[model samples]
Target: MPAPGSAALGVDEPRSASAIVGATVTGHHLLHIDGYSRTKHKLPTGQFIKSLPFSVGGRSWCISYYPNGLRSEYADFVSVFLHLDKSAGEPVKARTKFCLLDRAGKPVPSNTSTTEPYEYLPGGVGFGIAQFISTAFLEKSEYLLDDCFKITCDIIMSEELRTEDRIAASPFVAVPPSDLNRHLGDLLAAQDGADVTFQVAGETFRAHRFLLAARSPVFKAELWGTMKESAATMVSLRIDDMLPQVFKALLHFIYTDSLPEMEGQEEAVMAQRLLEAAVRYGMPRLKLICEDRLCRHLDVRTAATTLVLAEQHNCHGLKEACIEFLKSPRLLEAVVETDGFEHLTKSFPALVKELMCKLAAH
Candidate 1:
């Protein structure tokens, strides 16, 4: 049928349909069954009831049930499934919960009473119970209403998206650098214009009165109150008990919230001394660090001393760690022969009793 100068016709454009945008909407979808028992004897292998399709939060979903079970392994139990029919982009995650309805049209009590979350991958991915409940249990169970059982799936949708900025996101910037520690360190380093000094053994350490007062309430009372250290312009506070190195480490901890590593026997010994000094100055964080270090270095040789120190300062963590290390009869027997053991037994007898109680319980 050839025609000269003739043009073919085309259909007109249809009206535009509205599309969703912005943040992914969220909602819960429910799929209910009326006579669940009616499908109880469908097929022994597996069967899907008329696929009840549901659309929620811009995704397609389907609910199905298998009477004799989904797999041979689950043949003794009834199985239910939640399937992702269609998804716009990447896999979407949703939670599904199945229920057995009573005659009152409410959920019946059954072992299948929990929410199951699943990732619906692109193409299709599904999740469900392979062994929900035995058929014998459900058949006689009061869950059936006129031999009708119902199931409800609560579909929870979420906006799981990756924006351009999220692809290479910056780490959280929580705490900005501040002058509190650095400036305090400056006061410790520059000792120029310092107003206070501490004498340990024969060494004199330069310090600031306000710095000590700000750090420790004990120092505040001694440096500014009726104490003799308050009166002098360049105050000299005498501490006869502590060594020069231990006292220096305490000042470092006050300026910088850190401590030296527990390297060897000497540093471990130094840590014990520093912990007591920290306790005297009301530095709980320093004491906690010391406890952690001491716990790591615990041995038959040091366990007795660390336990005594823990008891004296009420450092419960260090005390418990000491007791735990002594759980070995060999270690405990060796610890009893150490010189520190004799000292601890003589000084802190109550701690000995407490250790005995914990070991007995163990």
Candidate 2:
């Protein structure tokens, strides 16, 4: 019983033409319409924006424009606003949820969002923002967006929902540097009954003096037991015997996670000790450091020592590195002159044979 234009203005009765246009054109693709007015005032600039329905993982989503639309200039206007509901619910914030894509349509890591901004040009051809809402939120919430409309609402969410959920549930706990230092100091203080203190890397520990008393077999056995039981006990002790020092260093690292410093040292002696320790303890990092130093400071005698350590430690990698120093023409000639070739042949027959064969072939 209403007037003729009442349906168009929601005051008069139903109109066939308006209903037909509204029914047929519902979709996500940007519609190019000329002179379409929504209200009775007949505004020229107004346009209806709808999103294409996308299905990801069997869930549906409805995307829509923000209330303020492009006028808000919030930089995310072109981006599709997402909601699970087909009816009415407050739309979640989309900026933090949307995946930004690059020119090639590759999803950019979110960290890059801070540095980059997208600009919309004059033509209708421009990138649109796509935001994702979690399925858990959709499942638990009471409200729903209008599912009857097929064009604008598509549910495509990322598989990272589980990871995001875990990250949200657990919070990070920060520890102060001073507290860590205090705890380390307490650990250092606990070993008061020791004599010599040897620090390797940043770790400090105590050592009993008698353990390093030269030629004391009893003390050596006891120290060896301690080394076997807890290799880290040597961090505080300096045993003058190179062999024992190497063994203790290696054992200490194996039992207690610590690395000894390579400062000072009789260069050749320390290199040999460190090399031996590296091999024994299976410390690849320490081994590489020792090998580099030895290579720089190589002499005929040290090369011989390195060769022996390489073989003893079964360090194939270190052996190959040491071979570079030992196979040098100068070092090889020095070995021949010093009658050290015999020692080398005796210790590393395979290497000596290989070197001899290469020399003969050359």
Candidate 3:
């Protein structure tokens, strides 16, 4: 016989009295299988029932029942365990319950141990009620039918934590950044098979039409739409308003889908032109990046100019930020002297009125 207070589950698992057991029954999940005797009699103790599926915490889970012992040592008894679906992609920290019921729906709580909570990580340990009723003992009992017995499992994960171990992690395969940028950079740098040319301020930059069409809707329209500008080997664009440095920055963005590194003053200087180009090219993300950079550099000297740029580009966020910045009379007095203030006052006279009212109120 097992020694006094010794566990029959072999590992001497943590008992129900441990505080890690279910603190709150968030919800219950149950499973029952029949035909216990005729089918399970021939199976080995270590065998598991067909994986029963359930879900909690918006994650997948599975339950396993070992009708006989999980090992030869425990073959005389039944074992049941709960397994987390590792394919769910993360560990599930949870508390588990296994219950055995008689035909009368009466409880058999004598030894239906509730396992201490554990994180169900991939390739990690599963939790269970190891010391389920003995096979021989239940064979003659009412719960064992002519050939079957039913088992149920209840899982109520912590609303705060999906698993018991907060730090536990499942095996994972790392995903590195794709080589899209590198390949595109190679294509742009080599220009080995350039199919098109862009003429900006009488300077020509060689590029592939397909690459530009892929990155910008404006380019797509010009290259592939009714315009069909790409049908020619070289397309002349009168981008006289764009500086060569700004155009270079724009091309770097198209090829890399990211900004090129620039010093502080250079970055600020490039922002307005980049934002205008982004809007002209129909790239909202690039426009937003430029808007954010511009916003970070706002000062009395730049506020009025940025306000004009935002209004011209329909950048409501930057416009609002500029208006808020000029709430100070000193700031507004300083901004009104800038070159762009004449344009802002003429374009948005109502905004000037609103600012005057705020200054009077202040």
Candidate No. with top lDDT: 3
lDDT of each: 0.65, 0.38, 0.66
Cα RMSD, model 2:
23.7
How many clashing pairs per prediction, in order?
A: 1, 23, 5
lDDT of 2 by residue, 53-138 (tens): 33323333333432122222322222233333333122211111233222223332221111011111111121223212222322
Looking at model 3, residue 52 earns an lDDT score of 45
Ranking of models by lDDT: 3, 1, 2
Candidate 3 C-alpha lDDT tens digits along 1-362: 10011112211111122123444434455455556664467566666664545555556665556667656666787777666666766665666667776564434543355766666665344556545776766775557676666665667665455333476433342122245777988888898767766778778788777788888988887777533644646554556678887888888889977677654567777988899999988988789878866775788778888877887799987887787788877888888898778877888897678657766775
| Candidate 2 Cα outliers beyond 4 Å, as residue runs | 1-162, 165-260, 263-268, 277-296, 339-342, 358-362
Name the runs in model 1 displaced over 4 angstroms.
1-183, 226-232
**Candidate 1, residues 223-337: lDDT per residue as tens digits?**
8863353454787789978999899888877776655333567667887998888888887777877776677678989999999988889999888889989999999999999
Q: After superposition, how far is residue 51 of candidate 2 from its true place, in Å?
A: 41
Candidate 2, residue 204: lDDT? 48
User: Which number leads on TM-score?
Assistant: 3
Task: After superposing candidate 3 on the true structure, give the runs of residues whose Cα lies further than 4 Å from its correct spot.
Answer: 1-174, 225-238, 357-362
